[model samples]
Target: MARVDVRLGRRVRDRRAVPLAISLALGLTVAALPVWATAHPAAARIAATTHPSATEPVGEPGGGVPTADPTDTGPVPTEAPTTTAPPPEATPPAGTTEPAPTTTAPQEPAPTTAAPTTGAPVPSPSVPPVRPSAPAPSPPAPPAGVHVTTDDVTLTAAYWNAPSTVATLRVTVTNTGATPARIRLAYTLPAGLTDAGTGGCAGAGGGEHRCGEWTSAPGARFSTLLRVRVSGDAWRRMPLSGSVRVTATAPGAPGPATDDEGFAVLFPPGPPVPGITLDAEEVSFDIGGGSSGLAVRLGNSGRVDAEGRIEVVLPAGVTVPAPPPGCAPAGTDRTRCSLGTVAAGRTAELRLPVSATPEAQLRAPLSGAVLGQLDPRGGRARQLRMSFRITAAAALATPMVSPPAPTGSQGVLAAGTPSVGDGRGGSARRTAILLIAVSTLLVVFALALATISLRRRLAVPSAGPPASPKP
Candidate 1:
């Protein structure tokens, strides 16, 4: 019986040895897993697939174990195998002897793939914010409150005399604004009227005139008299019209203020009387050497025949050097020509050759008048005055005075008399000859004086031989 018990104990020892070998194999594989996973990343993926729940928790304080983030897009991480306690052995019943234990290899679990995570939201690309903008500017405004006014004028039969009559115009400028402003006045004269050179207005050409600036206070008014002449032909148009404009002179001011006026020309109720009108052409001549034709036109607007004498008066240094066949010198600066018995509705004209001297005043007006009678016995005389301008000629040269012609000579110059319209060659020759003759005379006088001085020295005997050597 003692020997049988020993054999049974040996069998029990053999059964325990199998379980110990299995535990040792599992521990060795777990230790080598980290080294194998580092060498082969593909093996790590397979190992992760094999044990999904074996992964450790991460991001927890004081827990060094790493875990897979559910939101991570990278490959799943692998985990090492963990050790566990062995299950307890089962005991047999007392009646039957125990059979020998069978030894078998552990079966590996099938590799499981991790399902796709679908919890955390994916973030969109970052974007920027928006903003706004700004605005524009405006324009300027104008001024207000100024007034201009003028009075009407009338001309009478007395205006149809030798010279034209001047009619006065009254213009008033008033300011209704609260502020004082400087303003200027401008006026335009219509046809058949001209500025009479009497008013304080300056001519701006083209029948326009302008006055000086005046400061006008609120509710204050000022008046100016403008004199305008009624032209000789103004009788044709009985009524005339004109306009006045007032404008502010300040910066950024408004447009102009305007007013209009009219003139009425009246004549007496009677038969049509004899009326004479005169007109002449404007002339431009040189001071020393130019001539222009002076045409005097006499128009007799009468019912019956009329007889008249036309007289021309020129300025100083101007003359009608060669009068026409029917013209004669009336005075030093006047010429008279008869217009013998001009029929009704007939016009007469006389042309005279007018000349100017070197001493003539430049830009002076040549004035004249005409006197007419309806009856040769006795009647009222009618006169008309006319004028024309004389301007300096272009390209002036040296002035030369020509000798006057002999009396009673008709358009005939004296022998060897140089005329004002002669060529430059003759003038140059005359100048050269005069200079040569004057130089020759000066040389002859100098030689005669020298000879006389020498003869006087010899006749004086040298102060009697120096008074015998001063005794």
Candidate 2:
């Protein structure tokens, strides 16, 4: 009975084990179907994503392909900058950096660099910052050696020869400036004087007259010193001077007509001896300093052409030209001015300039003597000395004089002719001059005489009215 019961149990166990095995197998198979389903779906999705559709592209293994998504750009949408700034310090290598050859600013994306303007801001294309550079410095000033200065000038004169026949003048100049300058000296002689030498100075053709009575010597012209009165080519030291013009720059600017010229005080009249004479024998000028010229007129009181010489004495601080360049002197004194012959019946005139410290004080009187060489005798030289006060500024002109009538010892005058001629006599013209001179003198003398007479008249008492007419 035990064996049989055991067999029945075994059969039941076997039945249960078979069914369980079968059920387990079926469940494993069902789970395996899910894995296969998941694989197939995943494969289909990967294929779809691999190739981009109209809306999107697939993700690649290494890099994602661009997608044409409505929300995203085909690639990535990029935004450009509104403006770019240049590097504050853009120092390129010395050789590599070039000065912007063109004045125009580099053609920026936008084009507008027209600037007289300063403190401007410029925009540039996007670029990396450059290193800052140092600015260039300015050049230096001139060295201490170059300079310019005035030439201290000295002048001396003398009158010599019969009847003051010759006038001699000498001048010297000294340098005071730094730097060796190629010096030149020039000056125009006062009118009425011809040139004394040649090759040394410039010349003007004023010495000769048109009446054909005067002849200009070969060297006649304006005065100037072509080169310094130096011995050799070497530069002479400053403070050196000779009978020459002390020069600086020329008169005018550098050009074709430019010349080495200077100004001087002369017998300021042009084409001199335009037939003139003083109303009287002499006129006095009491001129001070700072005067540029003196004016005067003369009337023709006689019949023949007349001529005369003039002399001037400068007060302290005043100056008279030394032997001026291109001037031929009639006498040794540089101040002596000569006017050619004036017709006997005509009067002549002139304006004279006096040199002085721009502002000098003139005290001593200015005396002028007009004498006609009426004869070879000693008394024939007529001289009139007058007094004048030099004014700070020049005044009106001097009145002209005509020749006086025939008078004084009669004989040929300086012109080497008869003392008196037909029509109104040259002597008459002289007389008129003499009368004016004498009258002027007499006026002064009369004043003194009158003062004395008045003093005496006042001092002498009446004799009690002659005792009342003797009652």
Candidate 3:
């Protein structure tokens, strides 16, 4: 009985060993299933080759050893495991085949073990702190000056004799300085040329036109137009050829003075032999009795009668007397003495009386010109200009003394009084006249008395005194 009992115990122990080994193997396979399911294709391939019987050890709960399915299908068997493991989860549906998962190789971490063999360590690129830089220096400024220029001139001619021709000029002035500058502009015309007007410039005329004291801002420009007239007979003979100069001057400028010049040439129609001559026999006059006399003659050398005016020019403070025959006051210091129908080859005489005002300067010189035109179509006669000297006596400094009446006894006194002719004042004039008359009469009486006395002494005493002296 003891031997039979030992054989049966050995067979039972062998049966129990098979179940325990399968339980441990199933626990390990369940634990490794998720890793194999989630691994790369290479890893899957390795797991497939290394553990082909991985799931075969698991069995059903009723206690039969589970068989491996050729195609992966069905659920995992529920069995009590000998070791701890996660639950088996299904990866695919009942009918579909699950594709193998793919993954890239794990990149090795940046080598922390060794230094680089070829080059030094490439430091992580870092940006430097932003800092401001200084600014560059500025350039210097230019010098200061005034700039000037002119435009081309336009000239026109007319057949009229009064003003025969006209000329126009335009000027431009510029300020190139940083600050405001003052400028003066001047225009000079040739002889026989006169300024008619300026478009925008205010100026004075004295053979030239001058506009002054104009202020201009920096980079500012000014433009002006000037017009002139030519009326003299000389223009008929000679073509008008001259330059109109525009000058810009600044007293203390940083640059040179500027000159802008333009030239002009013009011609006008000529007239017939209209000979108009102007002459003055006496050119100079001494101021006497607050007045002076000018003897002027106008001769017509042409064959036709001349019907123009005798234009006379005089200085300021001198004027023609009232009621001057055939003479009319044209302007200040100017007179138009009309020559009514002067016959051919005849001469006309005129005595122009010019009186000086209190403002007249002593020893100053003034000029007078006599101009005449015989006919509109004829040429102008020779125009003569004469200079006059302003000479005045001491009485001119005082109030002008009235001359004696022409028809009164004072006329006789004035006619015989030499002192009155000499421009003597009232007080000294009367005394000098009286003293001269009395001394003259006394000397004549004394001479007569002495002659009579000498005659008597010589004749009568010759008879008696001669005989007595002989005895």
Candidate 4:
């Protein structure tokens, strides 16, 4: 009997154990379904293997037990009410003790339909800050050392003569720096002067008359020669002056360097055509109180006519009467003659009468000078001189007379009678002798007649006179 009972209890325990193992296997498969679906493409097949349809009853063909189905998803429902009965308790097999059961909380299931969307919000991608770039700088300028100057500057004269003359103006440009430079040279001509087309210069600038441009190397020099000429009546009123200017700079320099120089002009005197030549004869004077005469001749020796005033200066201790026409007093002891244009090769005469005062001495010299000019505003004048003698008053007053004239029958003066065609002048003398003879005969006849009358008177004597003769 004990054996039969133990066999039956073993059969029951085996049945319960198989059902509980089946339920636990189903739960674990369901829990693993979501992970399997995510890692594989056959998610529907995995769901079918895990949960059973709710409409299907557990242990349909066997004793009361739960089982898995492949189709529907609703909870299984109980059949129509039959009887209200409690479940029966199970008994442990002999020789073994039953273990106490443990209570466990239910766990939430993982989603199998859709993926979760609300994980930690993804942070925006990190980025760094930005900044702006700067522009490049410019290069620096060149250094300074250049010069401009002249050559033989002392040769630049301040004054000139004649109507025109030639002059040299030499300009030199020097570079006293390490780098090359450029220079501009120029000059200004005074009125009535021109630049004689003779220079080593490049052509003039566009708007500047005498300026030019050039380029030079380091420590190099350049030169230009200018020939200047004078013209017109420039020397008549005043002289003309010219000037030069030089400007220097580097290739890209900002400002310029400059220098200046100047020159002047003048004129010389003219030639003689307009010259005068004078001549005079020697003169003599009585020492104390007497008069004398002088004659002077003037010749125009120049090619051009002589005009302006001609003067004659006299010494002291001499007296002069009224001067000839066209002559007047010109300062002390001087006489001036107004000569209007005396033609070339022509001659003119001046007659002057002079006297010596009581203070005059014998052998005293009488001197005279002739000063003449052509144009009062132009050329230099000419001068000439003559000398004579003075004599004592006791000398014969023999008047200095000119030669006798021809027979004009004006006045008969014996001392000035000129020799005629023949020598016949005795008739006037014979007539004077005849008158003297007649007067002598009259005196003799009168004396003889008086003698005859006396003889007659004696022959007829008186009566008483004859006797008295004896006594």
Best by lDDT, which number? 1
For all candidates in order, the CA lDDT equals 0.48, 0.29, 0.44, 0.42
Model 3 pairs in collision: 274-378, 274-379, 276-381
Considering TM-score, where higher is better, how would the candidates rank from best to worst?
1, 3, 4, 2
Write down the worst ten-residue block by lDDT for model 1.
77-86
| TM-score of each candidate structure, all chains considered together | 0.28, 0.19, 0.26, 0.26
| Model 1 lDDT tens row, 1-471 | 112234345445544544454444445445444433332233233434433321222124453212222222333213111111112214423333322211111122221111112233333458443233422211111232356555555555466563667887766555544444455556777677788863335666676776544444433444556678877675444323456666543222332333223222232211134465556655557545576667767777766667867777665666888888878998897788887887767778878887876445332222222332333334566665544444444222323544332322322223443323334434544454454455455555555555554564455432222223333
Q: Against the true structure, what is every candidate's RMSD? A: 59.9, 55.3, 66.5, 86.1
Against the hidden true structure, what lDDT does model 3 obtain?
0.44
Give one digit per residue, the lDDT tens place, for model 2 in 297-383.
Answer: 444344444454444433444444442322233442224455455455654455555455532322222222222221112223222
CA shift of 451, model 2, Å? 93
Any idea what lDDT model 4 has?
Answer: 0.42
Q: Candidate 4 lDDT, tens digit per residue, 1-471?
A: 112334346445655554555455455445444433332223233333333332333332443211111121323211111111112214423332221111111121210111112233344578443344533211222322344433221111233334555656565444443344444455666565566654323223331233334444544444455666655344432223345566555433333545554333323222223366555554566544555566667676766666645565555555456777888877766777776766777866776776655444221322333444444234555543322333334232223545422322211122333222232222322332343343334434444544444554465534342233333
The true-versus-predicted C-alpha distance at residue 205 of model 3, in Å, is: 14
Clashes of each: 0, 80, 3, 0
Q: Model 3, which residues run further than 4 Å from truth?
A: 1-274, 283-288, 376-471
